[model samples]
Target: MPDTYNITLEISRYDPESHLSWVQTYQVEAGGILRFVDVFRKINDEQDPTLAWASSCEHAQCGSCGIMVNGKPLLACELLVREAVDQFNTHTFRIKPITIAPVLRDLVVDLEKAYDRVHAAKPYLMKPAPAPPEGDEYRISPETLETYVEATQCINCFCCATACISSHHHFLGPNAMMSNIVRLMDPRETEKKERMDLLYGESGVYRCHTARACSFVCPKEIDISHFLALGKEGKF
Candidate 1:
């Protein structure tokens, strides 16, 4: 068996100067275990210095390397070269930036604007439940935390938002909805009613079609659509 395979990447390219977009192709030899980030690095270092993309921590914790591989949202750092080939049954891969936000350049989107909904969700505890006794800290049981812990794993990659069937203009998107749900489930938060109001508001959980595409694309494997379901049913 061969340790390396020649792969072609059809990456989306955007030019801010002319406001044009096109597909740029590059062929590189990749190891089966090499991740897509490594492939991107190889391309940038060897073939094209003009290519641009976003990446912070290469460990998949920062969620900075989010992109669409054959129209599927995924973290480039987590997808192995061979895994992509096997998943699509092709040696050529199409790479595009997530569409939830406007593209700034090649493979880079405006993440600040993309996070607007998440910011609107108010990710912090707005209202406190109550103060703990003097010299004592508030305690939350693991059993209770388990209910919403998965939602907290979201790194704001916006992959779920990109994969959502609902239009971002009308829906809060999965990560934003999950952010509110996490706060609502917390025993330390006393602003449940307000969060619930927002959840059931015009651009809220109701916009979700329960397609579960958000769950399918989440790099963290979080069941984001489940929280949307719970929110729609007023379970939390």
Candidate 2:
């Protein structure tokens, strides 16, 4: 059975120059089975056609629909409105724009800078020369694969970045570090030492304060702290 209720969404809207902010409230008939993304779309179609947001895949895998729901970073496609009401025990879900970054419009945020930072990390595999003769695929044992599996789940949603206090002041955030860790832990990669050297540099993993905020807000449940710890201990 699905529970039906009225939800009040307080969304923050921004305009160019002087950091102008405004709030628009929407009354929605919602259920526990309906995601916030759907609710937002319904509200937009019915009440405010100018409401702006982002989404892709609508399955939490694309990581494009990240937003601040009741001051928490969440995937709009992943959370149901009624579940949110139950969790907070309130009919009104106050969604403010992300505080760490400048809001582009309604719910859409400017993640261009964050994406640039991610690219600067060069988070990718650098494989050695291919094997000769049979040229078989590189084999990774099951046990070894298990170790790096968690880090590989990142969808680059930047939710972790939104929650990270370190990134609030121009830090690189956790996603890149997580990416680095994945490659560092991969059995096929032979560039671990070189990658670690870059990661341990001033603007790299060393900037992390072990705040754990990144892991706390990650939709994928990636343990960013564990990877940071590994980097600190030179254990990767």
Best by lDDT: 1
Please report the candidate that would top TM-score against the real structure: 1
Instruction: Please give each candidate's TM-score.
Output: 0.97, 0.90
Query: Tens digit of lDDT per residue, candidate 1, span 127-220?
Result: 9767677746678899998899988889999899999999478997889988998898889999887898888899888899999999999999
lDDT tens digits, residue span 158-234, model 2: 88888887876646778877787678777677877778776787667878889898889889898888887787787
Q: What does the lDDT read for residue 160 in candidate 1?
A: 95
Give the CA lDDT, 0 to 100, for residue 222 in model 2: 86
lDDT per model vs. reference:
0.90, 0.79
Candidate 2 segments whose C-alpha is farther than 4 A from its true place: 17-19, 99-101, 127-129, 132-134
Q: Against the correct fold, how does model 2 do in TM-score?
A: 0.90
lDDT score, candidate 1, position 8: 92
Model 1 lDDT-worst window of ten: 129-138
Count of clashes, each model: 0, 0
